[model samples]
Target chain A: MPAGEICIIVPCYNEQENIKNVIDDIIDNTPSKEKWTVLVVNDCSIDSTGFEANSTGKADVLDLPCNLGIGGAVQAGLKYAARYNYDYAVKFDGDGQHLAKNIETFIQELKSDKADVVVGSRFCTKHNGFKSTFMRQVGIKYFQWLIKLLTGKTFTDSTSGFRAYNKKALKFMSKHYPAFDYPEPEEIILLNKNKFRIMEIPCEMRKRQGGVSCLSSNRAVYYMIKVSFAILMAAARKPEE
Target chain B: MSAIQIISITGSLFFILAIIQAIRLKRLKEAYALLWLITGFIFLVISCWQGAIDIIADLFGIVYAPAILFLFMLVSAIIVLFQYSIILSKQNDQIKNLTQELALLKNKAQGCSKDLPNKES
Candidate 1:
């Protein structure tokens, strides 16, 4: 096959304050002129996230009629990538935590033909960026332990949303990804069951440029328990193949 | 009539009338209306023939029969709720798909409207 299309999927929910800068950053940092398309999924924001995204005209805005959470928003973008038959689909947060500068690294890594899904990890290297608070770090470690116990594979930063997916991964997620809550850790179990390869690339993550994170201190605990059950349920069932 | 009898009779009649009204006004789909009708019919029969509850409860080896009647009603309600949960899950999947499709179509249309592909130099 020849060179393929790369679609950077930005799932936005009330990120009007940071969305324009996010789009501009991606456009400024991308190496290719027309190969990469910034597809932003505005998740029915009550604010002007949709308007800001559309006004920039640099990204293709997919305005959802109803809010479907992060999974639905991201999956909507994935479905678009699958429909248009893009070779690579990358998920970047709309709150500006994810930097566009590392996208070239992701593309280069995907080109290396190693992992079907490439996770941009904040804990992969000593020179990491903004490694959250102490409690959040402990929560990350707990998930790391749980994943190792269940799948016998170690994954740091299981909840990080900055990641890249090739066509095969994008297609799979477009059809069967969970549409309710956070799907990062759940996706690991799914990929493990289905026998897909995942690789991690070191990424520099920053604090959010604007808006509040969905996971609070209290909500983080609930997130861990909920994701644990979801992982267990997924692992308990046999793979469809 | 006893207090329990009056309550059961009134409850069952209310359910039946509610189902009928919902179907008549097109508030409930015919398929779903059938489920409500079945529940109301079961309640009506149990209220009218109280001995039937004893026989069924005795068959299940429970000494307290009326307790079983309430338990049965609870189970039926739970099953209906489970059915609705399944329906909601399916509808959720469909809505996600439709939203994704609509977004893609809208984007493509915008692109086309901006510049007709064939007209490009």
Candidate 2:
């Protein structure tokens, strides 16, 4: 965001082959590599993901003893950002899908105070990158419509993890995040309820270079139903004071 | 007495023995075992002296005495489960806090390692 410290969090599981590539890409593409540091939350990977990330000597690796899933791992990273007094935090996937070149663009938006959170969207204008399967596209449309109906905010890619958070959002999420299922979907509701401004811009994403998507095969239906129900339930519940 | 009374008394007695064994083995905490101990005692008393429950049930306008026993059991089980749920929620919060702390500690440790002067240079 500003000229202050920024932490790029990479929450990965079983992604040993791609973690080094991710670190190199970030260092090569970040506008100011000196201002940014990479923090890899290893999410209790069963493989050598932690060792690979650590051996890179470019990113710090946090190896969790138990698998806390993607949301829990990312929250741990946020807490790290807050503890280190980082001015901004960005969530970058470790599967080599997210482009590090977009870091500058996200920083520009945050510096300009465009929004409290800047999300890298594949559908902000045109889907120029790797679009999900047709079924996933349908699921994305479902979330987009549901979010608009509930919070009156429109979103194209509701599940994109490539996002940047200002200090306020980072600090708040470091402690209080959606602890239940569907972290990304429930996050939209939580942010809206807490009055955090979220904006998305068009960005390109490559297909995973290593591991498979968690929602690759048959879990898509379950994810869609779970997130849809979670969004509706969040709308019904009163915002926590 | 009757075979039903004898069976119920022996069954409750065996349950009490099993619970004590579990507590002794450290499989169950004393705080949690207290409820089961009370439940076992209630069962032993009612099964031995069926009339006690009959009188208690009469006071509560419960026609069927054994039905009152089941109701009490159901209510107690729900309360116990709710207590465990509360404990679980607190543990979950603690786990999240510990995770955050561990990550921060690791980051600091890494920083220290990098800051160390190279000996081979």
Question: Which candidate number has the best DockQ?
Answer: 1
- Model 1, A111-202: lDDT tens per residue? 78888888988998889867589988998898899989998998987888998888888899888786779899888888878887888888
Q: CA shift at A24, candidate 2, in angstroms? A: 1.6
For model 2 chain B, the run of ten residues with the poorest summed lDDT: B112-121
Model 2 global lDDT (CA atoms, 0 to 1): 0.82
Evaluate all candidate structures by whole-model CA lDDT and list the values in order: 0.84, 0.82
Q: Which stretches of candidate 2 lie over 4 Å from their true place?
A: A1-4, A179-181, A232-241, B13-27, B34-38, B41-86, B115-121
Which pairs of residues collide in model 2? none
DockQ, model 1, C-alpha based: 0.34
Cα distance off (Å), candidate 1, residue B19: 3.0
Estimate the overall C-alpha local distance difference test score of candidate 1.
0.84
For residues B1-121, could you state the per-residue lDDT of candidate 2 as single tens digits? Answer: 9999999999999999999999999999998888889888988999988899889998999887789878988987997888799889888878866876776676566566552111110
Name the best candidate (by lDDT). 1
The TM-score measured for candidate 2 stands at 0.83
Candidate 1 residue pairs in clash (backbone atoms < 3 Å): none
Question: Least accurate stretch of 10 residues (summed lDDT) in model 1 chain A?
Answer: A1-10
